[model samples]
Target: MRSSLMRSLHAAGLIDYYALLIHPLTLGSGARLFEGPAPLAEFELTGSVTTSKGVIIAYYARH
Candidate 1:
């Protein structure tokens, strides 16, 4: 999903959890997942796993 839409949904309290896949690579710079100014929110890491290919599947619950 687009960052804008995600931000909107989060701001409206429509999001309960987040499942993110993190790759073990990075370029010099790129677009961020959460862009621009947004309401402050907290999340707790509920679970996570690492794939054989070094990908991290992380789960977080909103607080």
Candidate 2:
């Protein structure tokens, strides 16, 4: 989803000056959640598997 800050920046033609802050990704094998008015749907994404203790145990895709 687009953030309000991004919209404001774009309106002022300052897109070059704005950047989305990135954070380190958590390693895990779980479904990502996206909620809307309707039912949630699962999309294909790539990542790593994680255990109960937050340890990365395997690849998201077996192949």
Which portions of model 2 miss their true places by more than 4 Å?
A: 17-63
Tens-place lDDT per residue, model 2, 1-63, is 345554554455444322223234666753322232323223232444555655554322211
Candidate 1 Cα RMSD after full superposition onto the native fold (Å): 1.2
Q: Cα miss at 41, model 2 (Å)?
A: 32
TM agreement with the true structure for every prediction: 0.87, 0.23
Per-prediction RMSD in angstroms?
Answer: 1.2, 11.8
Flag regions of model 1 displaced more than 4 Å.
none
Q: Give the Cα error of residue 15 in candidate 1, in Å.
A: 0.8
Candidate 2: residue 40 Cα off by (Å): 33
Q: Rate the local accuracy (lDDT) of all candidates.
A: 0.88, 0.38
On residues 1-63, what C-alpha lDDT tens digit does candidate 1 reach at each position?
888888889888788999999998878888777677767788899999999999999999997
Error in Å for residue 11 of model 2? 0.5
Q: Which candidate is the best by lDDT?
A: 1
